[model samples]
Target chain A: MAPALFHLFALLTVASAVGVVATKNAVTAAMSFLLCLVGVAGLFVQLDAYLLAFLLLLVYAGAVVALFLFIIMLLDTQGQKNWGFKKFPIFVSLIALGLLLTGLGTFVTRGQLDAPNPNAAGGVGAALKPYAYQLFTTYLLPVQVMGFLLLIAMLGVIVLSKKIDGVEDVK
Target chain B: MIDFWSNLHPVVQGLIKGLAVIMVIFPLAGACSLAERKVSAWMQGRPGPNRAIVPWIAWIPFVGTFLQRLGVFHLMADGAKFLFKEEPVPGHVNKVYFALAPAIAMMPALTTITVVPFGAYFNAAGDAIPLVLANVDVGLLAVFAVSSLGVYSLILAGWASNSKYPFLGSVRASAQLISYELSMTLSVIPVFLWINAPGAPGTMSLAKVVEFQSLPGFWGGTWFVFLMPLSAFIFLVSLFAETNRQPFDMPESEADLVGGFHTEYGAFKWSLFFVAEYSHMLVGSGVFTLLFFGGWNPLPWISLADLVGWLHHATHAAWTIHPLFVGVLSLGIFLGKVLTLIFIFMWVRWTVPRFRYDQVMKLGWQKLLPLAIANLILYALAIAFIQKSAS
Candidate 1:
């Protein structure tokens, strides 16, 4: 049952990820991107990382992807031209292809190919407790720094989006 | 029969429960629509939906007249109208998304109900069986996570319609849902924080929450609502907004947005959005009742433990009461509470005028969010102080 769910969601994630890049319309791309996120979330659930699964759905599927759609809609991309295959640069493509192959080779050689089922150790609540404890205790400073970084980014967004009285003519 | 039933696969059990839930919820959603009309009519001093009745039933005497006057058959009429109505997709609309939106909208509302514990019954082996569909450990989180996907449906419908009204409606819906979602999530933290056993991870399970409320010991087994009234209030208001109910229903304010994100949708598809909305309301009310009210308990600090003494003596069975008897009584209690909450929803819909879009946003972000955060902090401090004193 677990293996079947894993394969199904994995296939869906890959297909939708490809669809995200392959689609012409921005809205269609965004929708496919959402499907990819959902598939990933499903995979997380299959692995018994229920916290990560829910968070992925809640944060990404619920908010971030919706934001992407909102922005796409606001921009009115109905008339935007689709990118053509001919416009791609061969050298950049070759670099990306080489990087992917190297990463896969390294993963196959070094990664633990048969890690034991993580959920076997404890229930869902127990699984999340230690990760949460580590985040708040050992990694507290890094977490705070990340939060501060997000705050600054939010401030930047507010500043950029703010309407200045004399800015329309100046721009 | 009982042994055979108990031995069935969990997947098959889930499928059966899920189907049963659909049968119940779909009809309840229809009934809510009927109630909305009746309630609105009463509030406005007018006769409401008293006409639609089956001809055969209507031909009977006083009982038939009473039934007709109550408009018991109106839901059937409404369902038929929706089914037979013309479904015209506008030419310029995005065909794929337009078709997909209603199904997406309805899915989460249906799925979220799985984790909501209507009742719990003790089996013959003295095991407590929760009357929930999917008894996941992260039950409440599962509800939130699944229901959040509902916003996508509204956004898709709005954008796919490719019309100005729907576009605006969807945008408002996204912003509104996102804004309230933060406060909604935060407000529930305090409930779980207080419910948590010392040094143990806080439970997100609905059944656990109910168990805490029903137990005899530990803070006198008080309902979370009375303990954290402010949290309940915050949660309740957030729920109203989250379900896009009255005053906060700016997204689909007919006067302003002409049915909002579903402006272009008609007939069956349109009804699906309403089903989704009402289902959200139903589930939200149920969640509130579970979190705040003493779910499945006639009163707080009153579990089946108290009844066990009497039940064992009466039946000469094991300490556990019969699942069927307990199940029916608890289901009745749970549904009674839910219906009361639904009535309040309808009452509020009639009593409160719609909030202006800006006011809705302000209340969600400025008012509710800050209040919820403060509530969480206050509860945390109180819990810490109590723990320190106890030690």
Candidate 2:
């Protein structure tokens, strides 16, 4: 049952990932990306990482994708129906292909994919304790760094977006 | 017997629960709409829908006049009207998304209820059984995650309608829902922090939160509202905004946006949005009750489980009756609390005028956000200090 569900999610992820490039409309492509995210979240759920699944939904599906859709609609960027293969940049495509192949080769040869620890503290209540403790103790420095990174990114966006009273070239 | 019941296929149990929830929520939504109208009318010093009576039904015995006066039959009439009303597909509208929008709106509202613990009951063997559909550990988070997707419905509806008013409404909805959602999520953190067992990972389960509140404390039961009134206030305000009720109904402010996202909708499709709105209100109220109010506990000091045990001993009747009685009582208590909260929502809607869009934005992003963050920090320090002193 579990394996079948995993396969279903995996299939959905692949299909929607394909849909991301296959769709002509920007909004449709964004929606496809959202679906792909949900499929990935489903795979996480199958791996018993429910927290990751919800966070994926909350952040990507709920917030980021919604914002993407909002922007797409706001700009009204429709009618880009040109889907010719000639338009595709060969250089970027080759780099992406090379990276994918390298990742797959590593997985097939040297990757030791760790199965989720079945004996690890089970249930949502038990899982959060170690998750938090580890974050605050083991990964505390990295977490703080990430927090600062996010704050910096936010400040950068605000500075870029917000217009100064005397600034004429902002727009 | 307990094992026998527990061993039933989870799919079957889920199906049963889903069916039961639909049966309850649909009528509850209908009744709430009726209540909203009547309550608003009484507050405005006018009679509400007291005249919408079926001629045949109004000719019956004593019950007929009572039901007619209460305008109970208006619910059926409204349902029928929605069913039979003319539904048009505009030429420029996106057909597929327009059709899908209402279903999308309704789905999250229904799905969120699965994690809500209505009550708890003891079986024939006296083991406590929680009365919830799903008891997932991340229950509260699941509710938020799923319900956040409800924004898609309004956005899609507005875009699909291909109308100016709807597009504006949907845009407002997207911004408003997202903004308030931050404060809503932050506000609930303090409640969970308090309810979480000292060394445990912490629970998001509604039932567990209720159990934490029911434990004997300074007030006989320590409701989170007593400990974290700021969180409760933030949560309540955010709930109103999240559900798009007045004075936060800027998304569909009738004066500005004809009908908001549902500008082009009529009949069944339009009614679906209302049903979704009411269900959101219902679920929000239930969550508020469970988190702050003593869920399923009849009174402040009274624990339903102990009272049931006493009642069983006093009656000296069959064992099954005690649990059955307790289950009913608890369900009633839970529903009663939910109803009162819903009434408060209605009362506030009528009392408060709608906020301008800028005012709404400022309140969500500037006011509530900082308040919630400060509350979280305050509670965290308080908890840390108390724990240190105890150690």
Candidate 3:
């Protein structure tokens, strides 16, 4: 049952990812992206990481995708159907794709990660307490840096979006 | 038969349970529509939907009239009409999404019900354990995650309608639902913090929160409403907005937007949207009751265990401790509170005027969000202090 579910989710994720690129309509692409996120969240659930699964759905599928759809609809971007990718970018993406497949080939054929001890103190997929403790302790600096990065991005968006009536008001 | 049932896969068992619950909830949502009509009529000093009746069934005298007056027949009529009515697909509208919107509306509403524990039974050791469909650790968060997807249906409906009013209504809906979600999420943090103390299992389960309220003591036995009325208030307000009940019915503001996000919908599809809306209300009310009113408990201080004890004391019968009896009674109490809350929802609908779109936005972001944040900070400090000092 677990293997079947994993295959189902993996298939769904891959198919939806393809759809996101293949679909011409902006709204359709956004919805496909949402489906891809849900499929990934399903895989997370299968790993006993229920918190991560729900957080993924709640933050990305719930809010972020909805906002993406909102903007796509508001902008009515379908008129740019003729705006296909240029040859140079396509050539670059082909090289990137080859590099990705080569990386995957190396990992599957030769790469071996250090087998984690099952009795470790805490890890990413542990139950809430150990998981939370790891974040605030072991990964504290990285977490704080991520928080600061998000804060900076938020400030940037506000500054860029907010219109000012008078320019050069500051001394 | 019992062996076979026990041998069934957990997923199969869950599917059976989910189907059973959805069957019950679907009709109850239908009944709610009838209740709304009757309540609105009563408020206006007029009869509502009393004229619809079966020919032979109406011959039964006082009971028939009572049923007719209560509009029980109208539910059946409404169901039949929606089923048989013409399902129109407009020419200009987006075909796929227009067809998918109502089904999308229903998925999350019904899915949320499985996460909520509706009743309880006292085990032999005498702990009142909740009977739920899927008793997951992230109970409330699962509900929030799924129900948040409900906005998609409205957005899809409005966008697919390919019209001015629906487009506006859907936009307003997505904005309102998203805005209120922040406060709603923040407001419940305090409740969880109180329930999950220093050494506790750190669960966000709704049943465990109820269990915390059931514990014997001044602080323990008191419902969260009496303990944290501000969280309850913020949660209730957010619930109203999330469920799109009046006066927060910005999505459908029929007066201005001509049925809001569902403007182009009709027939069974339209009925599906309203049913999903009522289901959301039912689930929201149940969550509120669980969080604030001591879910399945008879009163604030009186736990279900206490009630069962009192019953056993009164009757001195062996049947009082029976799981079936306790389950039914607890279910009755939970449903009783839910019905009362639904009535208040309808009551407020009749009493208050629809909020303007701008006002809804302003209230959700400016007023409720700040209030909820302050309430959280206060509760966090107070709970931290109490737990620390006690240790």
Candidate 4:
């Protein structure tokens, strides 16, 4: 049953992922993106990484998709003509796609490709205790680095936005 | 009740429990609509919806008039009207998402109930066991994640309306919900930090928070609201915004937005949105009760076990320890607190004027979010100091 469930989640992930790329309407594509995230979260749960699943759902499906839809709704007004395939963009997209496939191939060969048995105990991410313990101990330096990076990015944005205030003529 | 409940197969038991909670919540959500009307009317010095009555019950005279005046029968009338009314599809709207939004609204409202431990049962040894549908380790987080999906329904309804007001309302809703969610999540961190002290096995189960409240000492038995009052205040404010209750109900604030996201919606679809809103309110109040108020504990510094023991001593009753009786008593206390919180929700709705849109945004971002962050940092420092000193 567990293996069957895992296969079902994988199917959902792959199918919705295709839907995300194929859908024409920007809002529809955003909704498909949400479904893809949900399917990925389901796969995480089947792998017994409940915390990772919750984070994926909460962060991606919850806030990120909402922001995507918000922008799509604002920018892509109804009855607007869809952007046609331009020459330079098409050439760039092809290069990007080639790079993506190459990265996928390398990762697939080196990553944890075999699924753990259904009854096997999950690794660190299974329960809150070990995941949090490892986070504060072994992974503390990387976490701090990520935090500082995000802080710097946030400060940069704040500076860029506020810099416009004093230079504007309207006020 | 315990034996019959335990005898069922696990899957069957889960199905039955889910159905039971849904059944209770659906009508309760409906009744909340009527209660809102009555509450607003009472505050404004008027009788509200006191005319509807069943024909056969009219023969009972005083009792009939009493129920009529209480507007009890209007609940049935309103339900029938919504079911029978025409569901109109606007000519210019997106048909699929317009229809899907209400159903989507309901999914999270009902799903969050599975993780919330509402009441407790005591064994012969006086150990209080929480009665919930699924007490997963990732309890409160699951509730937050699922309920966050509710914003999708509002956004869809607004965008699908394909017109001026609804699109605007959806825009406001997307911003309001995302902003307030930051404060709500941050505010609750203090409670969890206090509960998940050093050396304790880590868990995020809501029942464990309540169990901590019920311990036998002064500090242990005290509710978190008294200890972390600032966190509780921030959480309550964010809860109002998250549920889209009045003052912060910028999504469907009828005054300017003209019915907000549901402007293009009516009849059964409209009623579904209201029900979903009420259901969210119910679940939010239940979470607040478990987090800040004592879950099934009747009073401050008085745990459920203490109450049961006092009753046993006072009456010398052998039946006080009966699981059925204890369960009912605890359930009553829990539900009573939840209902009181719901009433407070309505009371504030009637008394407080709605905040201006800019004011709402400023409060969420500038005031509440910073307050929540500061509250978290303060609690972290205090808790760490205490833990280190103890060792």
* Candidate that would win on TM-score: 3
Worst 10 residues of 2 chain A by lDDT: A118-127
Q: What is the interface RMSD of each candidate, in Å?
A: 1.8, 1.5, 1.4, 1.1
List the candidates ranked by DockQ, beginning with the highest.
4, 2, 3, 1
Per-residue lDDT for A21 in model 2?
Answer: 90
Which lDDT tens digits does candidate 2 get at residues B1-391? 8797689897786797799988999899989999998899999998788878888877899878888778788888899999998997788998988999999999989988988889888776765577888788888888888889898898889988998999999999999999999999999987777667486666677788888767665654867788889999999999999999999997789978989999899999999999999999999999999888988987766667767756767988765356666788889999999999999999999998899999999999899999999999999889778767876
Worst 10 residues of 4 chain B by lDDT: B121-130
- Which residue pairs overlap in candidate 3's backbone? none
Indicate the residue-level lDDT of B330 in model 1: 82
Off by over 4 Å in 4: A80-126, A163-171, B1-9
Cα lDDT of model 3 by residue, A123-146, tens digit: 445256777777888899999999
| Residue B131 C-alpha lDDT in model 2 | 87
For all candidates listed, what's the TM-score of chain B alone?
Answer: 0.94, 0.94, 0.98, 0.98
lDDT of 4 at A55: 82
RMSD of 4: 2.8
Candidate 1 segments exceeding 4 Å error: A83-96, A109-127, A163-170, B3-8, B124-127, B304-320
What are the models' TM-scores?
Answer: 0.93, 0.93, 0.96, 0.93
TM-score of chain A of 4: 0.75
RMSD of each: 2.8, 2.6, 2.2, 2.8
> How do the candidates rank by lDDT, highest first?
3, 4, 1, 2
lDDT of 4 at B361: 95
Ranking by TM-score: 3, 4, 2, 1
Q: Which lDDT tens digits does candidate 3 get at residues B1-391?
A: 8899899998998889899999999999989998999999999899877888898889999988888777799999999999999998889999999999999999999999988999999999987789899888888988899889999999999999999999999998889999999999999999998888776567878999899889997887999998899999999999999999999999999999988888898999999999999999999999999988999989988899999999999999999999999999999999999999999999999999888888998999899999999999999999999999999
Cα error, residue B318 of model 3, in Å, equals 1.4
